[model samples]
Target: MIVLSEESQRTSGKDAQNMNITAGKAVAESVRTTLGPKGMDKMLVDSGGSVVVTNDGVTILKEMDIDHPAANMIVEVSETQEDEVGDGTTSAVVVAGELLDQAEELLDQDIHATTLAQGYRQAAEKAKEILEEDAIEVTEDDRETLVEIAQTAMTGKGAENSKDLLADLVVDAVLAVKDEDGIDTENVSVEKVVGSSIDQSELVEGVIVDKERVDENMPYAVEDANVALFDGAIEVKETEIDAEVNVTDPDQLQQFLDQEEEQLREMVDHLVDIGADVVFVGDGIDDMAQHYLAQEGILAVRRAKSDDLKRLARATGGRVVSNLEDIESDDLGFAGSVAQKDVGGDERIFVEDVEEAKSVTLILRGGTEHVVDEIERAIDDSLGVVRTTLLDGQVLPGGGAPEAELALQLRDFADSVGGREQLAVEAFADALEVIPRTLAENAGLDPIDSLVDLRSRHDGGEFGAGLDAYTGDVIDMEAEGVVEPLRVKTQAIESATEAAVMILRIDDVIAAGDLKGGGSDDDGDEPAGGPGGAGGMGGMGGMGGMGGAM
Candidate 1:
């Protein structure tokens, strides 16, 4: 059992919130270096001692079993990115972290937390603008680049030879779906089913065929056929009430048996008028219905499961099932003839109705089940990414590119908004500085020196003043308009700063008892038979500051 006191409640809440924010920022920063082309790698070890090395932000966050609420929120950011864009999860997180780091300075200078949050939002708006300015329209030549980009993104996402094969597949799929307006990703969809192999591979316009023959003598295909796959039994057979009872004495049972024969005959006559060329039954058919189907030239199949009936409905684009009593045009799907043949050590079924085919099955071959699974995953991710990109347009750089530029632009904008708010605005600019600083750190360079270099090289004037350790020469970044990938670095900066400021702003922690007491009319009251309340709820008396260092 657990008991909470007012003081303890107050202490724990603040400490926990702060711990979460601080630890989360650190985690975000750790992954920042892995952004962009020059990004570094992270080697992670799981509880089972399994090892993984990758710079992928989503993978990194998921693998690291962090226990901070604030940090988890950052993870949620990546999840959102993945769900919404199919990519750039790392970018969003990194930007949020950097924004948080920037906010921390303002917090230190006594700027309100709410004010810092507002400033960060403004800065984000500016950064988005920079991204828009950098956007370029994709063209014919750019398709290969885009393919390479898509392929690169898909690598290790699980396809073998994804570098070439996956890229080609995407291009082919896109071309197949393209119209005057461009690729129609929404209309071109794919579904996979697991079954024994078929012929090598082929495309058909209509859906594939899958229905068993009801009668052994029924023809495989009906030319220009309209098919109906039904759920109800077609047999005229009925189990009559006159069937003999199991009770002892054979004489009493013999009298009841005579009535059953009469009822079975009437059932047979009713089925003949339904006009069913073939009647598929979901269960065993009675002998009477079987005999009627044979005499009336009606094909009868029995023992189909309800699931198979539903599949048949979808396959033929038919309507729902009706009772055996009412069968009409509205309740039936089209009927067709299908041919099955052995090809390449597998059974292949072909259905050719009048006009063109609407569906095709692509037989993807793989050496092992795992390999196939991976390939399928890659295909799915690739398809999803393509669809998302087509819907949303191109992605911004993964490392802090446009965002760093945007930060600088916002700083200039802040200079004009003079007042106490300007101080907050400057603090906001300082918070934004973390993006570039983080980018520099991840690049294995000095943050202070990088900032100096960035400023000196800012043209509209002169250049060159930094020492290169290799050549002992001066280097300039501004003249080149050089900025690292904004996505990765900005994510780190925003996540870190947001986390840090959130930790610092926490002033109170309330416990169950505290809430209970606060809710009561009395100003104070001691709980009966409970453990003594400790003002230091987190058990860290005077150690509250440690929360910010997480």
Candidate 2:
């Protein structure tokens, strides 16, 4: 193994960590405005020239062509959020970014890097407690309210019917994937395939076929059929010599045709050997191939589209569609089957274990193709957000119950820790201010002393944290809760904390020249700013800064 000098190694590590912090914050900030009901919107065009306009965090992150490892890490946090909660990815990224930002500010004041890092960790712990302490009980009546909360997060981006549709779809997806473990809410699954337009969303007893019938004479239905969904073309190929043959005589041409017929018969035999009940071909079939299949009492449909094949595979849970192009081993996916039944008007239905089948087909309809396309996108975004929100353990009270409780707990926890660690812990407490600060800001309230007043009123045994002043009672939080998931409060705080720590660790900003001159030699320009520069690490472009230059 090659060994790096201690100084070189330290420099590399710091730069790597710094980049992660910087890129993460940039990605987080990009989606901040699209957070709540009052939040604005963003329209992004990806590198592929595809246009995406939405406030959804997952959509934003997914559409943004990001290459930085640090930025990708931030994306992963959103991914994890999507995977865990079915929503709140935007909030997580925003909070993480804000935490970094705040951390950077603390670092700039001659504070130790370690201290800021410790403070951030403590602050995060406190914030989590705050989230839990602030959680309000979710009641049956609030189910629609839960949906309203989800819709509020999704509105204005697209989906004119987001409130009604997202509520129903989100609930269905949640219930479908929800396990006995009290709703494994995070495992929201989505499958997308390009196919023909169908009617409004409905449960089909059998999978829908987007392929046109092979021929007018072919039977539209085959009862009690064992279906085989093939990814390969149901075509037979001419032998190289025969294909190139120049027929000088009619007799020679006849012989060549006979050989081709024999080859086609063999191909059909292969399908039979494999026990294919009803074969669905991915590409057009050759005349001879078709003739042989017909004679063999086999039902064959050709030119089946790829998307149709994928959807059918998922729906049937059968394996058969393997590579028809380039034939990579891993590209292979299974094709599922269902027993066939006659449906009038050129449509056919396949039912397999009627009682056991759980897959539902939502044949969404729209006035125009464009409307359908837009609606599909909206559904995808709603599904993504809902999935992320449900992934974690449970949502805390949205009306500020947990945050308030957490703030009190953190202060108590800090009081118990000893000496120097206590200072770091108290600083950590100060960091939690960013949460309520952000919530109030998004709620259209003054953020400055709002948190202070909230704490004051809550401590005084008042009915609620703050009075509306106009309402003369606790401010109504129903609308607030409905839009809470969309807020970037947690994200802002987290990002600031992260930024503060990253900047504080910067004792020096070394230039490329220093490293070439041999790591901190006596002749090296005195740490850029001198005296207060703090030795080798203190100089602008000094040993420490040089490490960062890369």
Candidate 3:
């Protein structure tokens, strides 16, 4: 009966369940208002006074610094959604919260937790099926629809005003990186530059090296350039063991300096002989080597990031030479031009105008740093959704159209099971409506009126009809150019359900006991720090400690 320690604390049975459910619901409510295009933003200020203004569910949850375990689980739902498809994070967290609320109602009706979990699993599987059935066919050739998908992903975010430009850039980036294995969004990089407007953003045909030429005396620009990439440094070797030069005479010092100058000259002559006009090195450039390369009229950029070098190789069709001795003619990649330009008051070398580039970069320009940072987040989300759409080859109308359709279909499917489990399945169907309802509420429309109109449209067999957050009219989402990837909806349902079921099954929470010190005396009497000293049996009410209504 005294299995736990004295300082331990515990909540059990109905109290534990209610406590967990409330914590999950609280997390859901925190981000509820950040649900749609019209949804408000969350301004998070951390303990250090650093601020983040984003409606992005994962970002908000990450910055919230939540303490409760169950609330953290709900945050994981958003994180999972973002990792899987990069969109629908808000919808996933909201759906999970609503699922917890619905399960709480069933707990009041004496339904066992296992039964609710089983029914939820069944409902989640059917929901994915409904989403697949509702999916509209889309291909890479459907540029218009793909752009719409990107636009929908950035609709209410900071990039909405420039969504058209951003979406087009995103779709183009995805398409450029598409291969037989599908599109890898990692091949595209977004570089933000302040002091420019949004519309001035351009898609660079090659990677943008955030470094400048190693020496200012070298050429600032080169056209029709032959590029060389190195994975090692272009500096003189230092002795591994400690060695001292006995420079008792001036001739010995001159001999040492001449030897170093000769070594640097050889390296520069080697590059000039290779006809390499632009060079990127993975390590530092020695000052003497810099003088030599500058004299040779070669542009050498040192301390380049390894990832940028890889990307540069891919774009320029060049191989990264490991050493100067291993250099060959084929190791040099070709670029139309290599130039150093001042962007946002910082000098950056551009390896661009590549032919048939497999890796690309986006130069995102904004009037300010914060504006560009938020724009970068929006562009990243847009790129992910577009890539998901192309990979799945299917999309669904956005603006809660998919949720409304799935809710109706799930209800009819729930009726086919006719048992206590059926009630849970129906509850799931109702929870799915939270998407459209939240969308309505965020847009300041009457939730009841919007829900009614939406259900009537679905009931009348119009599967595409959904609430227009802009006009409060129930119109066809497909016609309104609102769309998202099929993966977004299915992934959200799966993640939300798993999180809800997991939280619902926890009926006990035992916090760790305090580690108390002090030992008993030599007698066989009660210990010095005995049960009465802290929380032995007192913590559990002597085995009858299901406090409150158990």
> Total clashes, candidate 2?
83
The candidate 2 region of ten consecutive residues with least summed lDDT is: 531-540
Across 46-98, the per-residue lDDT of candidate 1 in tens digits comes to 54666665566776677665434455667777765555444555555665555
**Ranking, TM-score, top scorer first:** 3, 2, 1
Per-residue lDDT, model 3, residue 298, is 92
Q: State the displacement of the C-alpha of residue 205, model 1, in Å, after optimal TM-score superposition.
A: 8.9
Q: Quote the lDDT for 285 in model 1.
A: 63
lDDT of 3 by residue, 207-302 (tens): 888998988799999998999999988888899999987889999999999998888788888888889888899998889999988988899999
Flag the better candidate by lDDT, 1 or 2.
2
* TM-score, predicted candidate 2 vs. hidden true structure: 0.61
Q: What digit string (tens of lDDT, one per residue) describes model 2 on residues 1-550?
A: 7454445523343443343445455666667656544445555553455565456777667655454434556667777665544455666676666655555445445455676677566666566556545544444334564565456445544454445664576556544544445443223323233243323343343355644445444454555455566777755544567445588999999997887778767767766665554677787778778767766666677776675555455444444555333333333222333433433334443433322223334445555544455555556555544443444323333344334545555677877765444555556555444445555665567766676676776566432243232222344354444333422335434544454455444444333332321123356543221212212121212222321221
Can you tell me which runs of candidate 2 are displaced by over 4 Å? 1-27, 45-50, 61-76, 83-86, 125-157, 177-211, 214-226, 237-252, 262-278, 282-284, 290-314, 317-355, 358-393, 399-408, 418-445, 448-550
TM-score of decoy 3: 0.91
State model 1's lDDT: 0.47
- Candidate that would win on TM-score: 3
Clash totals, every prediction: 45, 83, 1
